[model samples]
Target chain A: MKPTNVRAKSLVPVARGGLLDRRSFILSGLAFSSSLAVSNAVASDKISTSKIDQSLPPWMKTPGNGDTEYGLPSKYENHIKRDVAEHTPETSIFSIWHTPIENQRGIITPNGLHFSVNHNGVPDIDPQKHKLMIHGLVDKPLTFDVESLLRYPMVSAINFLECAGNTAPNAVSLTPLDQTAQELFGQVSGAEWSGIPLKHILQEAGLKPTAKWVIVEGADGGSHARSIPISKLLDDAIIALYQNGERLRPSQGYPMRLFVPGWEGNANVKWLHRLEVTDKPAFTKDESGLYSDILDDGKIQRFSFHMDVKSVITRPSGKQVLPEKKGFYEISGLAWSGYGKIKQVEVSADGGKTWAIAHLDQPVLSKSLTRFYIPWQWNGNSTMLLSRATDEFGRVQPTRAHWRDKYASYSFNHYNAIQAWHISSDGVVENSYA
Target chain B: MPSRFLYPRCLKFMLSCLLLVTALGQVAAYADDATYTTDLGVALSPSEVSPYEITIFPSGKNLPEGKGSVKQGEGLYQNHCMMCHGEEGDEGPAARLKGSDGWFSFSDPLRVLRIDKYPILLISVGSLWPYATSIFDYIRRAMPHYAPKSLSNDEVYALTAYILYLNDLLAKESVLNEETILDISMPGKQRSVSAWPEIEL
Candidate 1:
């Protein structure tokens, strides 16, 4: 069945808040010229839909006409973009973000703006020439071209890939005035990944008894690599080639990426080219010194590969305004756990003083983002709102302070906390204390 | 009939004892280093060890020989650190290096700051780091994104000194050498917090 235009239809209601109104939002959209002119006149300073065409190169005049076998959202649908940036070059090419929790209804992120985290810049690779080599501690070293791997049976899973440092910046003491929780923790996203099971590849390579760790190396400029234990590879790893029902995007590891479910994002090596089984860790730079977390007591936590349980309230979070009303409002967010499934999520409308269990969406799969919603009536008084998540393992999200004291707020893994959102009597929604 | 069964049992017990004695003798010989242990029982010389085997822990024990000064580190910082971390180390489109009070600290109630209330040593160049080896290893392997693993050991040492100095943890005149690196203590060295939920953060 063809994909439905669900995004456009759903987004229609959101526009009603302002220019988001039906008539104005559509008319002002890049798809329509007349409305673009009107919107441009109203907001002269901002980049109007008409100006976008001028910024594009001639070859990109009709992004749709390229006749892609598998298409992404129309180029005009540019509202979705990466939430974070790298240190140098100031490009969001490798940047990623969690989907607005309240807005996520499906299993896959739209291709136009799927979250991405690249160690090096996204490399332009030709999939036709791509090949995977399995060597090292294996009994039979085998090389498989992309075509050969496709011949094997494939399985699809809806999973999320979260960077180990997804929320590192937010964990800091002084947040930038302009920064938001979404930008800080948004470097995570879920997708329906289609690929061959990693176990199948290891079997073909004839894994030796001594093979304890398998090192995955990417083809990016940094040659980013990491060593994962054999147990994890056989457990739920995937050599993902397709995302969201289509071939991988160039930014999301085009031909293939190693997807280690429920692990930190770095373990899910992108642009996968080689797999070398060995008796010990690869001691790659990413694992040994950088990605490793230095705990208290003068000891560094090494090889912390799993992302702990984490959840965040997306809407009315920060930089969003709420309407002043005494009526019922739906509090919604997303939660997930690396260990397993998310069993429950609790919401606090009174700065965590009291918590009410929120309703979770059905089919809460392991390592997948689960949608949650709670109905509440705003009393029109200034109050703090927060949401905490508890996974199946009974791991509950902590407060910011709780995470800081535990992880020392130094390294970025396992910073699961109940995010606080301050609602003012004036209906101003800002990130603040309870 | 009872005697016949007893005879077979005694014979079987004797055979098992003989096998056990042989196994014990073999183990003793292996411990004495008499046999060249290949796939069975033998110890390989240090030179015969795999070149890929290097595990750098947080302690300074595994550190390599290198010396760096804050003066030299300043030069490296200007060239490599200014763009992302900024000259003051407080500004970055990616992540700020200094003045991260509300960002990471939990003490500040404005929001859940990750750096607030964190032992400053936990930050780069601080006491929270258990090993000085990681600094040299990280800089030597990945830094200045454009050119990763390009820095020499000495250069990494210099950069490490500079970063530590920037965080105000190291003195300006302090010299960081492989021998004296472990002597430096981070502020969070004594703070032992567990990641487990029951530990009471």
Candidate 2:
């Protein structure tokens, strides 16, 4: 029922046995589709060269467009937006807006599309009055205003931040009709952050040998705070002042935020204002009551900071209608690990019957999103597609069954399982469990 | 192969080392004098901290001087918290505080595995909260949705005691103070698990 003329022509037959050639199959397939579009228009309209209007279109008929001080994405890309979902029905005070991962490209998430999770609500902060206070178990307690913090030496790091509650919906039930890749797993985002490292500030304050944890608090209505170990802060944490070469957006913690690389999104305290160095962890409400995961044995797992290895095929993902069945398509997805870099991503087109190594995009950095792609020729058969990622530490993404066995089904945090997308015979892709 | 450039290179390297040593001596002398230059942040004084800088740790080390009885807390609850948290703290808009059935059990078993039967079905301040100190900190910092940080220290203590009493964790006649509040053991803390599974690659 689907057109195979383009693919049939591209393959050269052998004399002894009929075998299809593989060279430039993807390239030629794309070219054939474009040519087919033009041929269809010509055949339907019967318009020749003499009757065609050669003048440029209305906008291009005039002079070239003038430049603006600030540039925005093309008008055609208006559909790309951060999708907001209300987590609490009592009020929109606590809400989550997810990044459109299905529509994004490369590793870095744009400033506007960065995911936002707010407790109480996003606070309108005046940077002029904002100051960061560093005290408790330090030789010299220090306070730095916005201008003073800017004077300190700064560093830039590209890392990913994922919410621990990302796969909460998937763990319960996954339906293709409603949820897409972005809707299910869009709580994670990557950014190139620029700021002074917390270690440099700690060194200036002179840390007491007894200092073990640093309680970072926000300036929001909740005064949301979390205690992180001193070693994690000293290792890679930064007081991020800018994101993606611009001062942070209000929802992303305007003026400043504490960026704890490779940790859960909540640990990166937004609207950061205070850092109290202490000998013990501050078992805050968010850490103990909300984010902490309870096991099947009735014991709680505390401070599970790092996310596990995970990958999801974004292209050919849920809700996407394939243009044609039996057409050549390229499967692309995102892979990330909180522990380290993603070493390899293996994609299966037949529900894990067989897997082929997907090509990793260049410049794969640790604790950042890595893009991977593979070309496949659809057989017009209803099949499932899955991507499994192995991190540098050799930790492979596990199945939902294995994960649920270890942790309780009600345990909603820190869920990282291999996602599968089903392709129907009618050329419709959907979210499915393989 | 050329001796001419080698001698000059050696001399330059030696001279650089000598200058480095001299510079190191000056830095050491400055350290001995307790004088240093590392531009960073401004030193903060205790008085400079904001009025809302109170954070109670798990050890109950930062509990302010305040005392309130369960009788005193009931009035505050009716006036401020009852509208959203419901009567008896179990029925509310946010989270339930007093329900005991299947509290800690999330799965179908509907029973907790722990030996100590402390009902923790709902994630409320009383049942699931690990630390007793979090109650005071959370209430003081964020409560009474319309007007936060409006409660006095004594009112916060009273409200905390009333919620604990409603959960059957505290006695109706008990008055909670800085010292007495620490002695109130939270059931969630007893069942807390510290170790994480070693996830090998």
Candidate 3:
């Protein structure tokens, strides 16, 4: 949907290149524009329903469309959708859909729009027939059907799931400058997931002292499997059954999926069924080849589950144009960490040269997306913009160069670097490396 | 009714005691505390779970039975995989399996020269996969792209053998079974390490 007009035309500059301290101004009862969200700025005055007569508008004159059992976003919101990034050459099923984070707000990703990468495609599983088995090196080898599994004590966690390969800055060929923040780094999304804490199941199975690793496997045709340490599963893992308080969408793994908070996404095996405890790491095809990070020394780095802190400016991102060449724009984006809550996010309008603190949206949940904002008065100049997020653990998101220096060489996965976007003098925004 | 009268009536008293015990037992089982274990799943026997134990561990655990020679694998590859994996396993739209070995050395880290294999990156059992068993495990789980798990254990072994043979790691006549596959030392076996020093974190 389109917006009427901006209300925050005058914001005091807090840093170089017209960066305004959004939190400070808002707290002091000063700023925030209503029309900042009116993207696709093809026309200045697209929709100003408020300016219409006070008596009635088009919607108010008639009864709304018949209600249905299931509801959907308004028809105007159809523009916001998950971008299908790529699939196996032509198979189309082995694919990855990028969440349009540019259009989304707040921490929880709508269940339907959550980013997904499927190996053998989304399986329409019958929850009635679905069963999760926890076996090997355990006193009791337990098989839990959906009914019995639901009987277990349930726990909910609001956490972010990020693909290991999300935002591989060095792999520019895969994600070019013409794309939006979602196309570049949409593999990460936040959600409120409710499920039985896996430790409860593991404890019931009676984990053997020798059980050091648990090879969690999906029931999908790909049999997508990963060797996760038993310790992590016991710590904060969940057998997630519901997403955003609803039965998980088919793509989100209906009935059940493994949820290892703060760990890499692939390890959270969707359509999860089996967990085999073992003494040593299994080094399955996924852990050994697919998700393994080939390092500088040519040695493969496996089980680097912790996703580092990262952020990206989604509003006015690639392909979007600023309505005015120079005006007040509330810069908005997401910052999150595998380590913990994002402590601070610094916005840089002049690339990395000048940095200013941006407001971390309220109730900054740990291991969840923290939306940040900074009201800026654009000077209509060709500028490079990026953000740096420092997590609670003191781990700051690194620059592309710095990250490459640390990891080095072939990166088929796990690259979190500062995403820079350029705004041209003509108001066109493009993904930037400058 | 008197408390003494209730205590004296054994039938009603026994029934009440049983109900109280059962309620207490359930309360103990489904406790609200996070630390409490529900012990709620059905225990299955090993034999019942045997059919689904598909995971093949690096240490050769769960490696299936049946054998296939590289010669047998070549024929099977031609029949099933050659369409996508290419006639020789090198020329394919999918991930190339076999290639002439000479990795562009990035020892200096700064100067990484792209030499030898270009355009199509080489990531196969011979060049990259740390374990030989994984080649079989993967082929068995996902192969032919169009039809997964359609291959019999022998066919999976056959493809694994052929791929290894194409990489020059195995002879044409060499056969691979559960035991033989374990003995085949892969080049990357020693080079793989966890990104985190401790997997616990």
* Window of ten residues with lowest summed lDDT in model 2 chain B: B28-37
lDDT of 2 by residue, A1-434 (tens): 55545443454421111112334343445665666543343346666567446575887556878888988888899889888764343263367788999888899999989998887788899999998899999999888888877765577778899998886666644233357877888899989998887887888789999998898999888899998889988888888999999999999898899998888999999999999999887788787676777777766678888888888999988898888767867678899999999999988888887677778898798899999886677778888888899999999999877877776555667888888888899978888777
Name the candidate that leads on TM-score: 3
lDDT of 3 by residue, A305-423 (tens): 99889888989798899888677688999998998899999998887788999988887988889999888878889998889999988998877767766553555477888888989
- lDDT tens readout by residue for model 3, B49-167: 89888878777888888999998888888888877666766544455576432233333231113222122333444666778888888888877677888999998888889888887
Compare candidates 2 and 3 on DockQ and give the better one.
Answer: 3
Span of 10 residues, lowest total lDDT, candidate 2 chain A: A13-22
Task: Report how far off residue B147 is in candidate 3 (Å).
Answer: 2.4
Clashing pairs in 2: B103-B120, B103-B121, B104-B120, B104-B121
Lowest summed lDDT across 10 adjacent residues in model 1 chain A is found at: A15-24
Model 1: share of true interface contacts reproduced: 0.04
Q: Which regions of candidate 3 are displaced past 4 Å?
A: A1-10, A23-56, A87-93, A169-176, B1-33, B90-93, B100-122, B199-201
Using lDDT as the measure, which candidate wins? 3
**How well is each residue in B11-44 modelled by candidate 2, as lDDT tens digits?**
6675576589888874322111111123446768
Candidate 3 Cα deviation (angstroms), residue A382: 0.4
